[model samples]
Target: MFVVSAPSGAGKTSLCRELIDSIPDLRQSISFTTRNIRDGEQDGVDYFFTQTDSFQRMIAEQLLAEYAEVHGNYYGTSLETLNTAEAEGVDLLLDIDCQGAAQLKKNYRRGVFIFILPPDFAELKKRLYNRGTDHEDVIQRRLENAEQELLQAPWYDYLVINDDFQSAKKKLMAIITAERCRMSRTTYLLNNFTVKGDK
Candidate 1:
């Protein structure tokens, strides 16, 4: 499992999208959201859009592995989704906010956690405006929230500075591949060979 978090407009989602396309074995765990779908987003592909009441029911039923309220809307990752992926021996990439990431970190200590950052605040502001997806006031709010979000980056296991899209994507893929080859995860390979009698 891998968990990724970044402030609004930091390109984490775009990076994760590319990573999914490049890695066939990895799957994105689509989150459930109470927010309205954006222009290019699909129902289940982008998010499982649901009513606030329905999201509340999920919270009450303890069906979500981790959830948080951001910009007045609720977003959650279902426990069922995580369990199913694990049962099938699949890798899952979770795109979530800091709050959800914190909860996941505590519960899934072994999962790789990464934080993405823009080259600087000015670039982040430029990207947000260029995207043209939010109002000026909303962008301001996100900028304010981003300051706080950046403070949470140090605790993450890896930090990917997204100065260039392709470089960042390559680094992200490298992180996943490196983690898969960690000694702890690969020590079982030693069991395949018997010790030779060298005297």
Candidate 2:
């Protein structure tokens, strides 16, 4: 499993989408949220939009793998989603916030945690404004939250500096591919390739 966390407007969503499109067996984990569904967003595609009461029910039932309240709305990843991915032996990608990422780390220690960073604060602000999706106050709030989010980068396993889209994508792909090639994950591939005939 892979957990990616970034402040808003860091292009993490685009990067995750591209990664899923490029990789054959990777699947993105759909999260449930109590926030309003934005325009052009499908209920199950972008997020599982639900009411606050429903989210509370989910929490009470222990149905969520990890959840957090961000900007006054609750967002959570269902345990069922991760279970399905593991059952199918497919790699899963989670586009989550810093709080969600931290909770996921506690529960899924083996997951590859990545922090996506914008080139700098100025670039981040530019991207936020260019998107033109939020109100002036909302944008400012996001920027302020971003500073605190960036501070948590050191807690992650890897950092992808999103200076350029292509370069950032390459770094993300490298991280995933490299993790797949690790001895721990590839032990089965080398099981029968020992120095058998060299004795």
Candidate 3:
């Protein structure tokens, strides 16, 4: 499992999409949320949109691997989905915030955690304002939250800077590739390649 956390407007979603599409045997874990489905978002596709009451019920029943409330909305990952992916030996990509990533690390120590950052604070703010969906007050709040989130970047296994979309994407792909070829994960292949020289 790989947990990716980034502040809003950091290009985390776009990077995750490219990573999942390029890597074999890797898929993004769709999270269930009680938040309203945004424009052009499809339920069960973008997210498993549910009511607050039902989301609370899932939490109470202990069906979620990790969950957190942010901005008055409940978001969580289903244990069943994650476990199934692990059983199939597929890498699970989690696009969550720092709060949820921290909680997940407590339980899933083997999971890889990656933090994505924007090129600079100026660019980050520009992207946020360009979105134009939030009011001035809301944008200010988000900026404050983003500053806090950036502080937690040192806690992640890797820090990726989105200076350029393509360059950042390649760097992320390299991280995943290197992880897949780690000694602990690919020991079987290493062992098979250790035979005495015949040629």
Candidate 4:
């Protein structure tokens, strides 16, 4: 499992998309959210949009692995989805905020935690403004929240700075490739090898 968190306008979604497209046997985990579906987002693809009652019920039933309220909307990862991925021996990529990432650190400690940071505050502010998706007030709030999120980068297993799009994508891909080769992650390969190191 891989958990990636970043501040707004850090290009995390774009990086994840590129990584998943190039890597086979890797799947992005679509989260469950109470927020309304945005333009160009599919229900099961981007997020499982749900009402507050259903989301609360899911929480009450202990169906979520990790959950958090961000920007007044609830978002969560389902335990069922994680179990399915594990059973099928498929890797998972999670694109979430720092709040949800912190919850994942405690509930899903085995995942590769990656933090994506903007190159600098000036660039970050520029990206946020150019995106024009949020209001000025909301953008300011996001900037403030981003400052706090960046401070949490030290707790992650890996940190990637998004200075250039292609370079950052390559770094993200490298992290995934290296992680897949870890002794703990590739234990199944040991089953095919003898004690003498012969297959």
Better of 1 and 3 by TM-score: 1
Candidate 1 is scored at a TM of 0.94
TM-score of each: 0.94, 0.95, 0.94, 0.94
Task: Supply candidate 4's per-residue lDDT for 198.
Answer: 46
What is the Å distance of residue 80 in model 2 from its true position? 0.5
Candidate 2 stretches with Cα past 4 Å from truth are 194-199
Q: What is the lDDT of residue 37 in candidate 4?
A: 93
Better of 2 and 3 by TM-score: 2
What stretches of model 3 exceed 4 Å from their correct place? 193-199
* lDDT by residue for model 1 (91-182), tens: 99999988999999998867899999899999999999999989999999999999999888988999999999999999999999999999
- How well is each residue in 1-199 modelled by candidate 2, as lDDT tens digits? 9999999999999999999999877999999999999889999999999999999999999999999998789999999999999999999999999888998898887799999989889999999999998999999999999999988889999989999999999999999999999888988887687758867
For residues 64-84, write the lDDT of model 4, one tens digit per residue: 988989778999999998999
lDDT of 1 at 56: 100
Clashes of each: 0, 0, 0, 0
Candidate 3 or 2, higher lDDT: 2
TM-score of 4: 0.94
TM-score of 2: 0.95
Runs in model 1 lying further than 4 Å from the true structure: 195-199
